[model samples]
Each structure stands twice: as structure tokens, then as C-alpha cells.
Target: MMLEANNNYDKVHFAVLAIGATAKAMHTAPSDIYLRLKKYNLVKELLFDCYDTLHAESIEGVVWNITEALKSRES
Candidate 1:
């Protein structure tokens, strides 16, 4: 489900969707993904801040990009 971002809530909504989709793809809980995103600040920098670009892609693409970003940032 694609959300049209007209306000802060929409951005938040999209972020949640992205997190949930990522979690599903990775076979983890949404809370885990949320924590990881928060830890890396991707929740803001990538998911929220880049909503314009991310939302234009497919959910699968978004999940792939997010997972790749997470992997790249891993210690």
C-alpha cells in the first residue's frame, strides 16, 4: 500500500509501512526493524527524509534498498 505524503503523519505512516515491509521480507518482527532503523537513524534519513524517492519505488525495492543500507552500516 502506497501512502501519499501530504503532512508529517503521512511521512510517519510511510515510514511505518516501510519498516513493516522490511521486517516481513527479513522474517523479523516490526519492532526489531524499528529499533534497527532508529539505531542507524535510517528512520529519519532514509525512510522519512527520502520518502519522495523511496515511495516512488516498489515495496520490494524499498525493502531491498533498506536492507542494503542496513548491511552497509553494520559493524
Candidate 2:
């Protein structure tokens, strides 16, 4: 589902969604929580290129991660 949210709202929403999706996919997610081992964008990109490799990961992180990655790329 696409949401038309402002900056503050999107951050809050992304945090919530990330945590929830991560929990559902087990403790090995890249969205919420502190990520020291793997970055969110890396895991997200891997999921995109090889979804089979990340069978246990959440598909929802793709959109959120892609958006963040795009923002960073533009910077």
C-alpha cells in the first residue's frame, strides 16, 4: 500500500512498519533495530536481485529501502 505522507509521518510510519515486518520475518531483518552486520540497503538490494537467497526476509522492506537508497543516491 502506498501512503502519501509528509517527512515526519513517513519516518514514524517507516519505523513502525519496519519493526513489524522484521519481527514477522524473524530477528534477521535489516529495516528496524540497530543494524551493525548488514545495512538495510544491501539486504534490500540482495532481495531484489536474488529474492530466493533472502527467502526469510520481508518483501515490504524493498519499497522503504529503495526510497531511502534513492534519497542517498541523490545526495
Candidate 3:
């Protein structure tokens, strides 16, 4: 369950990173990039759901999983 949650976060973060990189390469403003990214707010919500479901064991675990996933993708 935890692994699944992590994977969900990974997928979302990966997409965001890819989009951000593309926007940067295109010389787009970060705000404009974010505006486009906002279309995926639903995806962010779904990721939260996955975290809640898998980390029912502890809120901290869920946060940690998501943080790790985002850090992995961003860095």
C-alpha cells in the first residue's frame, strides 16, 4: 500500500518536473508554466487521495512518502 502511494506521487512529480523543464527550455515564465500546470490540480488531488489511503497507518508516513517522491523527482 505504501509503495503504491509512493508510486502515485512519483508519477505526478515526474510529470510536473518534465513540464517545468520543458517550459524553462522554451523560455516561458514560471507563472505561465504554473498556470498550465494548474490544469492538473485534479491530479494533485488524486495523489492526496492515494496518500490518505495507503498511509492510513500514520499521517506522517504519508507526508514522508510524498516528500520523498517529490524530492526524488525535483532533484
Rank the models by lDDT, top first.
1, 3, 2
RMSD of 1: 4.2
Model 2 lDDT tens row, 1-75: 245345445444544454456545455554443252135443334333444333344556544554455446546
Higher-TM-score candidate of 2 and 3 = 3
Point out where model 2 deviates above 4 Å.
Answer: 1-5, 27-75
TM-score of each: 0.88, 0.32, 0.40
lDDT of 3 by residue, 1-75 (tens): 999888777666754654455456547764554554355452355344453464353434443444454445546
How good is model 2 by TM-score?
0.32
For model 3 the local lDDT of residue 64 reads: 48
**What's the residue-level lDDT of 43 in candidate 3?**
33
Model 1 misplaced regions, further than 4 Å? 1-5
Identify the candidate with maximal TM-score. 1
Query: Candidates' lDDT values, in order?
Result: 0.89, 0.45, 0.51
Among the numbered candidates, top lDDT falls to: 1
lDDT of 1 by residue, 19-50 (tens): 99999999999999999988999899998889
Candidate 2: lDDT of 36? 26
Better of 1 and 2 by TM-score: 1
